[model samples]
Target chain A: MINTILCIILAILMISIGGKRGIKSFISLCLNFILLIFTFYLIACGFNSVIVTLLGTIMFSYFILFYVNGRNIKTKISFVSVIIVLILLTFFISLITYISKISGFGEESLEEINMFSYNVNINMTNITVSLILISLIGAIVDASIAISSALYEVYENNPNLNRYELFISGMNIGKSILGTTTNTLLFAYLAEFMTLIVWFNGLNSSFSYIINSKVFASEFIKIILVNIGSITIIPITAILTANKLKNTKE
Target chain B: MSKFSIQRKDIVIFTIILILSTISLVFVNNNFKFYTSTIVKINSIEEEKIDPITEPNILGIEEDYYLQKITGTIMNGKDKGKIISLENERSTSNVVDEKYKKGDYVFVSGNDITGLKRDVYIIIVIVIFIFLLFIIGKFKGLLSIVSVVFNTIIFCIGIKLYTNGLNIILLILIESIIFTIISLILTNGVNKNTLSAIISVIASMLVLSIMILLIAGITKYKNVNFNGMSFLTVPPEAIFTAELLIGGLGAIMDVCITITSSIKELIDKDNNIETRALIKSSRNIGKDIMGTMINVLFFTYLSGCLPIFVLSLRNGVSLTNYIQANFSLELTRFLVGSIGIVLAIPISSLISIKFYKRGDAR
Candidate 1:
């Protein structure tokens, strides 16, 4: 009941305050939510999670960039950069998950899931990589879009600037954005970690034990991976936007 | 300097980090002596049996399970260099059980395999992250890293006090203020703009807490499900509030600083700019930021719930029941967080204006 009320209230606020853009933001949120549920459904129904995540991320970036922010050079460049970064990140994430064997539910969740059968024939490693990818896509997309759009605006106002200068400007802009962006990502994950930390503290688990625990390690990895993706995209978006703007002007 | 020269410098940094990380990985893998439990380096594994569980469990799903006979030598502790044989069982899903291959390291006490030695992976990532921070942020990056480490330590200490019977809401409130002061000063430095942002964040957070309390009071927190946190021994209400206070602080701080800094830039650019124009410009900036921040939080909070959501749904829980059981908490977090982000915009603009005007007077 409270959930429905809160949703209604949030919806009303978004529409009223944001006006047209607000309504689109609200719609994008709903569409993305449904898409995620569908992705999980496919994975649960025995489809390849990695493949689903790939397709899902493509559609997600499309919704986030073209649908919410609109189609433009900025969105196009951001879309391209996001896809590129995600591809590179996929290889890195897969390698790490394979080596760490950090997939599957952790010991902390065993109490809640003790009654369920674990015989489902799915690669937990793949699922872990997929989860990490899903958790990170939003932040990456958000950061790239911010950079490309901000760079594009700079290009518009200073059309005489060369590609090299534009690239430097983008980096400067990225530097400013980087601090708060990472902090936002970090704290979001930390919030999720709080309960688990409390649970561990309650049990009086030693520092080494908690640090070495599967659950804590997995959560910490997810945070770092997202930060990496966001950071990498800054340079990529800057380069792409700068190159694109210069070519179009010529 | 040529662009190629800059590229060369980057290459050096990259190669050095790569070499250092490799060395650290070796050190961490071999440093199992630091552990209290005996660490085993699995040298060989023989599959004992592949058994299909015939019984449909609570979720009405069956799976193929495996049993392995593992032989390895102890790598650390008092039993160093002793051969040990252990039996392990893992299912295809491997929800809580790990599938060990030859050449894997595991912690063991006597005959039981306890857990995987994962510090090597953590150390590698941390090393790379710190380097990346240095590469991108330079001096500022170093400070931000320190602030993050400090904030994490402070958070742990706060949790310790909470477990020792401290009031969570009060504790987190104080911690939030401290975090804002320290992180803002560390990353942004001590300036009027930082001070303006600090005041703005506190103001918005104050309003946010009051708003949440009022809502919770009016609704009597009715239908606010605590099923997701059922294992917690403390009051879920208080813990959830603390989570909101701290979780929302990040986004609020982001919004506050962005507005505050942008306004400071505008004022610094044209010292005689009208207050009305400044207000309009900041609001426009705030609008763009608000949308993106909401989207970021939406996917972040919602994505974390997907695995558990799918797991529970497959376990035969209805969609409605699933939402009631697990998602309500996440939804509440997102909603309250979005409100905080939105609230920060006007509060920050108003505060920035006041602070800037005061500066003009001085």
Candidate 2:
């Protein structure tokens, strides 16, 4: 009952203020509800969450990206490439996590979580891998795709640009976009980790543990994923977005 | 562009980074142990003193403190099973809560319970963080802190409810909404523009949320192995919920800022431009902002986990296990959020175009 009331209030408020933002937000909200429901249902239905998750990401990404506006084929292709890159991210992150088996910082928060799963005899590796894969995903994919789309659209306006010339321009612009995208995550995470890192530092334990420990391990995974993910996404998106546009532009 | 060379400023920043890295290495050399405390008899009372080496057998590697094996209950977390022995004390960690007693579930990371002395380094970090935020954000930072405080209170309550094991999904939803409100209200304000920003943020967040659950369903990602986490602040369930909520917080703020600024820019420029123009400007604005937006997401996450990366490199953890175990859900949260920002450029463009169209039509 309370949930219904809350939902109603949220609906009214969203509608009242949603003026300039469009009802797309409403669509998003409903989709989110569905996501949650689907999550529950999948858990119950005994589906392989890994594949479900991939499909989910695609579905949501599609909604979030194209629901409000249309994109050309190149843009869609670029988006797909980002997904392809994401799949690689998943593979790499899981593989690393599974292999390293640092116990993720022995007694750290992750350890505690994994420990609970241990009691249940759950495969801690997969769970941790999924969590890790998704961490840097939002920002990474957002930045790359946006930049790719922008670069293509920008280049489309310049008919003098050949493929090579266009790639150079895109790289230059992509670098600029990449700079801030990096900082947003950098500062925010820095802001949150200020204390945690310092605490680690003060311990004056061998620097190795700070890096190798589970807590640090968890963070390391996030960074590497972002680095590899971003690096791969950029080139892939640039190539894909600019693909065949050589002729399209002239 | 100014000659895209390694400019003086770049050099200076690089040097600074080098310096910070060096300092970090010093920290690494020192093992990053900050807290300093040891379980001892009441000021040399000697009666309570036990074989320090017996406790925290792991302390053999700890350069920081003497071991003291003492049994106590963990006042918090899944380890509340019974009195557990504790030994090593690091500045970042603490001993069992005061109420901890033998036969009471307790897991110790620091020295004996009562949380021996805190490491001087942690205190320093706390002091530094406070000063930095206050200095940089000024009154707004203070407000941010207040916002954090208030949000934390709510988070506490939410977690408390979750600890009791209620509706995890509902809790996550409510928690996420509250977090969004708090984040927007704190950073932007309770104004129309803020509301617009919230809508933009919420919209993207909704998208990300959908993706998360959908993937969870499709991938059965939620069937996550719930091992090893029975010792944290809350049960695995609550922790997982909190993890998602907390993980999403930074991205929420990121999107909110991007949208808010873009809209503000649109409204400022004559407020009479074609929706198309407003959108173009928004995309331009997003274009300008994306660089720093994504950089911090990558860096912040990476920097926080710097030690882990370093450790992975040092210990030679296999590429596969390292990436899988090391990468966190928060990183995924960033990916999802960044995607929103990327997509938001077009979405905001469309909305702003319509925003103007509506005004002109009316």
Candidate 3:
């Protein structure tokens, strides 16, 4: 019932925004949503989530960068490059972090194991790795895109600007957005776990005990690792875009 | 003034908030109905069970389960400072449950049986979080903390409303809007750029929610089984919608603000830049941001659902059944929220274009 009311409000907002563009945006998003569902269905069919995620990332890039941005080759190249770099970065980081071993820290639903049939053999470790990889993809993509697009704009606005100048411009934009983007991640984590935090407070757990708790330790490590991944993307995207744009212009 | 002056001011503010928060903590602890207990001594330890299948432990003392008799002093409540005895259950799989040693403090209810062992830990974690935020973000950090407090209050109210039999979806939607407005205004201040971001955020949420409702309706809501969540009393659909609304709000707002502020910068750089060009620039920016924004939503949802994923997979559940039973809700949220993010790019860009074009014309 509330969904119907919100849809009405959305319709009014979309129409006011410009019926054509608004409708187009809505359709594009719907299609993207469908693609995501399709990816999961493929995973359910025994396909690897890592590969499915990569393919989905490629399709999503095509949709948002190429289709939505009117088939701009420059934007497409920048986005795809950043995604490639991000995937590589995540691979090496995950290897060193040993993030998978600790991934099973917060399984509160273990008591319900008997509820489901357990005949099929599935690799829990691989799935955990894939889950972490999938999680990092969003932040990496956001950072890379932010840097690449800002640099792209710098290049577009000033055809005569050199590589160094564009790189600096991208860095400046990145530095400003970094705080908020990181906060966005922080708050996102906090919002999800507020109740857990409240429960902890109600229990009056000490700081040492709280940090040592399996659930808290796991989430804390994830937040830190993701922040590192995001911060790394900024310079990599900036340099890559600067280099790409420089070569393209020449 | 200088940077040092600002640092000093921040430190002062942090100290004040810390004091106030500590005072409130004491007030809550004293006022609330809690049975406080402290560890006194270990009475005895006995092996209970090594394996459920085997009735006798042929291996003897090396058995898996151990029951410890822990005697403690009641620090508060009707049995204030009285000696008490409790059993602490320890298992080989310590990951599932913890064993408290001597000198530990715990909070027990009226029955004095079910008690939380580490109640003070969370308060320390929160204090550290606030301190770090203030040290890093300074004034903006302070404002972010305020915004978080407001959001928590609003969330509590929404939960109260839901429990009281109010329309959960409506409450969530209203809560989300209020949260977005307050967060934006606090973070970015009241300005044209913030307004554009706000509109974009609302538009994205609306689009995502509508699509989800349509899809849910079409599928007859088969995949959304909320039976697994033992705590839920309302319809699973409402809870699911509420989760999506709250889960997607942060990333959507993040994307919208990035696009809006970036476009605003471009316009300020060149006042006469055409609306067509401005819109193109914003879309380009959106493309760069879309992957990470979507991933942010994806990761947040994934992390929360990881335990269930692991539990199901470890139990040798079939991939298809696991996906159906455990992952459908998370997948719906991540995808629908991703769509909102994707749409927010264009919506924010277009809104900024209109705002900028009008400002330039005037």
Best by lDDT: 1
Candidate 2 lDDT, A1-250, residue by residue in tens? 2223323543443344343333445455456435633542342232454565566556655654565334766547656876887787777666665444422234444433321211111233444554454445555556566667677677757766666666665665555444334334433443344334433533544643354454555454454455445545665676766665665544
Q: Which CAPRI level is candidate 2?
A: incorrect
What is the per-residue lDDT of model 3 for residues B1-362, given as tens digits with 9 covering 90 to 100?
01213566766887897897797567534432432343232233333443432222221212255565667676655666677777656554332434555555555444343333333434433555555555444566567657767876777666666666788668877887898898899888899888888888888778766766666666655645454443332345656656666766777788788888889889889978877788778766665556445546655565455445544544455657765666655556566565566667777788778877887777
lDDT (10s digit) by residue, model 2, range B1-362: 21223556545644564576456545533432232222221211111322323222111211122233454443433433344445433211111112122232221355434322222223233334444343223334445546556765675465446546666567756766776677667666677566665566566656656655654445443434343233333334433433443454455556555666556656766756665566556655654554334433443343233223323322334545644564444344344444444545555455545544564577
Per-model TM against the reference: 0.94, 0.46, 0.65
The alpha-carbon root-mean-square deviation between model 1 and the true structure, to one decimal in Å, is 2.7
Candidate whose TM-score is highest: 1
Q: Give the B-chain TM-score of model 2.
A: 0.60
After superposition, the stretches of candidate 3 with alpha carbons farther than 4 Å from their true spots are A1-111, A114-179, A182-250, B1-7, B17-63, B78-83, B108-113
Q: What's the TM for model 1?
A: 0.94
Looking at model 2, residue B28 earns an lDDT score of: 34
1 against 2, candidate with superior DockQ: 1
Model 1 regions lying over 4 Å from their true place: B1-26, B57-60, B218-221
DockQ top scorer: 1
Chain B TM-scores of the candidates: 0.91, 0.60, 0.85
